[model samples]
Target: MDTIDREEVDEVCALAEAGQQDYDARFELSRMLLEPIEDEASDSKMIACCKGCDHCCHLRIEAYEFELDSIHAYYLRELNSEQQAKIKEAIVERYPIVKDLGDQEQRSINVRCPFLIDSQCSIYPVRPMSCAGYNSCDDSLCKRSNDDPNDTSFGIPQDQNIGYMKMRQMALVQMALDLSFEEEREIISGMHRRLFG
Candidate 1:
């Protein structure tokens, strides 16, 4: 629940503006800004999300354009042909299933992320801001929701400070690049479009 300082926000915005041409730098800056908050949460054991937990990965993920650019770049640059082919196949298969559905309906179904390989994120380092911001404090709630799509009775606890900072940073980045928050797109469809079209 800590508030981000104005100076920090201004600095990030200025840096983002200056580095407008570099999506990698923008994405790294966004991640750098959140590292401290993530560390604190981890130190306090406030996060229930752990390795091998892919519940959230099954949910819908939406990302800003620059974020998607970073991910796409990473996918091409870091992964080998085999890895890339597997992810492409997953995206192609999953996109048709979720494309026509609304966000709520997408979340209601357990559609796996293309990046999820063996219950782990293949592109963990360059995950979207929304994915980075999500910090579930109760794995059981996540499990419940994942297990029963109808069980929306409880909400997962997250660090609001992290969420707030992520939004602020992304907004500033978008402004710097002359982009709109409205340009955000669902990750799977976005990736599929990028990969195929």
Candidate 2:
């Protein structure tokens, strides 16, 4: 894919080789893979995702199996005991209802992400690729979409080179899968499992 840089590809493979146990290393690789997509989207003015604009945070977000492990590692390493407990409590409270909702329906629901703390993504640097890929050129459109989930007509101007970005995202996830076994689960449910342990 035109979006896949040879060096970044090599880095992903290297990170995979470093293994899932090295959570920090894997996170570094995720950040590297995401940086280009963010840059390209920003350069194209396609990214209107900003702090305090959490309309999209309610959407269902999934992670590569390895990425989920990384998130758990992040929580343990970065969050205080109280913060961790709070996240767990939120997941326990919300995941059951969310587990039954269809993807689009879940997106329309007003439930905030378990990881969203005070209108900001608490795990932003290592957030899921699905979350990273989301973009909007206009904040109003996002708000409208949130307000009226049935209106699927709302859309943002995506970067023209989205194919490349998609390829990169697939490459990163596939590489992680090759290195570890993980089944895809809804974000809250997955986090609940992780936090429970």
Candidate 3:
């Protein structure tokens, strides 16, 4: 994971609000953010993402137990020891209600992963594969001025692969495959509450 640009969230918020909680749009925005990049080009092409835009941060990116552990590892290194403690504290205090998820839900999606700071994710780096491969390319309801001649998000990119719009993607699968059963089990239970708050 990489550092996010703080400015791009405004575009995401406005468009998301207009979508009126459209799950598809929310999912798409969250998916695109799994890929954090600084050189994807700023063109209006179907695949070209905006620079430093982090609307995805505002969206929920559920994580499995392994992902939560991965983020814990990351914060230990990327953030100060105290910061890591804070994240863990946050998790311990309030992990959302894990719903009746499917079989694979533990692999990539569950309880919002116990890591979020005021709707902003603090562990971008080491954010887990689940956090890296999410994206959506639908264009029927973009918030940018559609009539503007400079806009690049017109029709969806024809050449772009369908993989660009998928969730619980490959990276997530691979990461889950790599976790230990103990780690995986703790994720499903509230036993690891001390790790994140």
Query: Of the candidates shown, which would achieve the greatest lDDT relative to the real structure?
Result: 1
Per-prediction TM-score, please?
0.81, 0.82, 0.40
lDDT of 2 by residue, 1-197 (tens): 35545666677778866756687687787687677676766666455667799988877787766678777888888888877777888898897888788666786665778888888888878787677777777888878877877687756554556536745676655654453213456788778777665
Each candidate's clash count: 0, 0, 14
Model 1 misplaced regions, further than 4 Å = 1-30, 33-37, 178-180
lDDT of 1: 0.76
Q: Which stretches of candidate 3 lie over 4 Å from their true place?
A: 1-44, 47-68, 99-113, 118-120, 138-197
lDDT of 3 by residue, 44-128 (tens): 2554333343433323344545345444445554677666666666555534433344434432332334445544556654464
Q: Model 2 TM-score?
A: 0.82
CA lDDT of each prediction against the hidden true structure: 0.76, 0.72, 0.40
lDDT tens string, model 1, 43-161?
65577877898888888898876667778878987888988989999998898998888888888887889999889888887787677777787888888888887787888898676
Return the clash pairs for model 2, or none: none
Q: Which ten residues in a row have the lowest lDDT in candidate 1?
A: 169-178
What is the Cα-based lDDT of residue 24 in candidate 2?
A: 67
Model 2: worst 10 consecutive residues (lDDT sum): 175-184
Better of 1 and 2 by lDDT: 1
